[model samples]
Target: MAYRCPTCSPDIMQARETIILVPGLLCDDAVWEHQNAVLSRHYDVIVPQLTRQDSITAMAEYILEVAPERFSIAGHSMGARVALEVWRHAPARVARLALLDTGVHSASADELPKRQALLDISAGKGMTALADVWLPPMVAAGRLKIDIALRERLYAMVERMTPEIHRQQIAALLGRPDARPLLAQISCPVLIGVGSLDQWSPPEQHGVMAADIKHAHYDVFDDSGHMAPMEAPEAVTSALLKWMRDDRGLCK
Candidate 1:
């Protein structure tokens, strides 16, 4: 379903083009709360729920099935990977692409066991305990201490998800396709962003992706972590605005 998040911005104008925002693992519409509020003013923005699928290919297919004939698409974390899959399947249908705080590599050697550790936590102590252990490291070191609201929102989102949903997403990610080969062949405008202090998917990882994709705009949100859309909303939004703009200056 399309998520038009509640916004203080004036009632949206008639939008001309569609923009799909894909949330990361264990995330919901709240993750794109800020961008949805602002971007909806100009485009037909929708945040697709990735909760049902057990594989990246399935998630991508879901988005493509629901999306417009042609649309600008952006994804955060695992969502970014899904966006890549979408592009991989139907590049001609994507008007523009944006990838934030994500990676293109397949599962690393140590990834499965590390992810299993969190799975074990959720299975045993429950989602709340898993959130306490897993969420902190995902953000910048001091972020949670200072941004109590961000911390709470993220925890609440994770807690709302059941262990089975988490397992399905993990399964999806573990079996994700290696997208590096597709990077050099992308013909559409691309935006790649990451947080300066993003420990999970560091800036260097994105820098390499930028190097691979021709003319991809690479941005780094300083003082932000893995959650760039939430942690650095303004900068991320601005970059997306520019990336989505065409010669006529609209998302289409």
Candidate 2:
């Protein structure tokens, strides 16, 4: 059986704008796979490869160069950092913004040790073992017991990301900026969400970002963690549909 979002259909794509989706650390299409199918039904969707640069700022510039003159951005985790950079560099180009399971702060010096350790582990033992240690924390702890397919999909995605790509993205995350200062400057409609159990980027952190954006819509998926798009796809997709259809979402 094929799944199509109730409000989304392939016929709706004509003359629509583009929406670029950016994935986080060790994430690729699998991160946006669900949202892409539903949302792309209405908009021209493009999921860019985020591995070409080691800095969020550079990555944003690269995306802007290739993206349509005006487009929305949906970025998760580290990709959210890059989206902020995009809005900072070219505010006029982004029609709407969605930041999922991400934060507005810089990594603490203490976080460096853990980031480096993940890199070292992946380099030494390979991505499968790294996925063994990692894939669990990405979802609500309860998900491991109930969702075998989600767990396997995440592990497979991580295993496909090369060690060098993982290291590049990790380094980019470790040295990323505190985006709080720029949050107030976002003039476009903003959508922010996080899993209630997201330790990597807690809901409270997204609340802070939403506080600064005058028109931000926020949500917390109780059944999810860092990977809300996968753990709670139906909920996330519905929220994204509302965001895309609302008149306020297209306002500058």
Candidate 3:
């Protein structure tokens, strides 16, 4: 079965299992370039555009509406929250799940004020100012300073994004509902990954999520931060490939 969307043509394809990858806030498919290249060798990979909707629920709904019948879902940061929403909406449709660098709880009181502050900043100063304030924390310490190419790529990607898109994503993040309560309801295998120094969504948050979810496996990538899949693609790919094969009874 395929879930077709009204805005886009039916992009779903037949495969053993579909893997829908969701990117983080203000991010497009560029974030999953590495994963898509590697994972496509093993399974059909789908990276749906999250631009059609402004809310997390709508994003998840769009993904569900356009995705194949049964698939494994994976997401990062804001995308991870969307993945959880998808699982909550249709648990049976997901064969397995990978929640990367994400948390189950909504932003705390302190966080909420900060997110709102960001909204105000973005509205007043624009995407450039927002990028200046966010890029430092979003990346690992010292990496941006040392790796000129990586830094250029990061900034270029940010430059391509519009302030309006950033505002909508921040709104979604600030308004996201707490997902901890839905953990017990998920019945599929889950893989939770975090970076050792990821301050945005720290390992402790993923640990709590792992503890609560049944059959949830958690891993931490040392020497990496919020952008683990990008910062340490090899490690991320190794873990993901292993999980996918092991869950599907395919030995390599």
Candidate 4:
């Protein structure tokens, strides 16, 4: 279903009991294409554009304003920060939460400088340059050596993104707050997934989160990297379908 906002007329589409997808830093809806396709079979899926805002708070607010009356929300990386902020602003509106390859911890004093440097590079050099520097660590070491076509495809995806939008996303990442204290406040069932080889947000982070949230379940994809939804779509879709059905007792 397509929607034209009553106030701004920005294009918005809703799927039944929508599942809003939030992509990571420097990424667009392209990142969640696989997951969105699979999930749409059973639910309404909305991959909101986060490029319109510069901070996590503003992005969350924009999403809230245009989202369905109630929906399930899932976010990856920077998008996860926005998801948490969305829940913080209106926990009762969320029916379920999925945090994929994300964390609730803030960057440490030691790590802040590195994050800032990346943000600076993204602002100055552009997303292509940043992708060249970032892709190796993002994918598993072995896969990078064995899969040239996949690497090239990923690089091209980043290259196609607008530099200005990428900068806004990086700014949001650097400015996002620590969401640890808010985890316990999430009353809905939460699915925490991570890539075993994702150094950026390791599997242990998901483990810690699963333990903290009263109703959270955790899973780690052994053969995946930071982009689990894209890298292991089958595993991700299977886990998500089971989790949703199990939690809601729907379509069992």
RMSD of each: 5.9, 4.9, 6.4, 6.5
Error of 2 at 199 (Å): 1.6
| Candidate 1 lDDT, 1-252, residue by residue in tens | 232222323454433778999999999999899999988888889899988999999999999999988788999999999999999998878878899999999998999999999999998889999999988878889889999999999999999998999999999999998999999998688999999999999999899999999888899998999999999999988988888664221222
TM-score of 4: 0.87
lDDT of 3 by residue, 202-224 (tens): 88888999988887879898888
Q: Comparing candidate 1 with candidate 3, which one achieves the higher lDDT?
A: 1
Ranking by lDDT: 1, 2, 3, 4
Off by over 4 Å in 4: 1-15, 248-252
Model 4 agreement with the true structure over 1-252: per-residue lDDT tens digits: 443323343565444557899988766787887888888887888988787788899999999998977888889988888999999998878878889998887766676677667667667988777887887888777776788877777787787777678667766776788899998776687889998889888998789988988868889987899988777778887877766654442111
lDDT of 3 at 93: 83
Q: Higher-lDDT candidate among 1 and 4?
A: 1
TM-score to true structure, per model: 0.91, 0.91, 0.88, 0.87
Best model per lDDT: 1
Global lDDT of each model? 0.89, 0.84, 0.80, 0.79
For candidate 1, report its TM-score.
0.91
Q: lDDT: which is higher, 2 or 3?
A: 2
Clashing pairs in 2: none
> How does model 3 fare in lDDT?
0.80
Tens digit per residue, CA lDDT, model 2, 96-210: 8899999888889799988888888899999998888777888888677688888788888898898899888887888798899998887777889898899778888888889
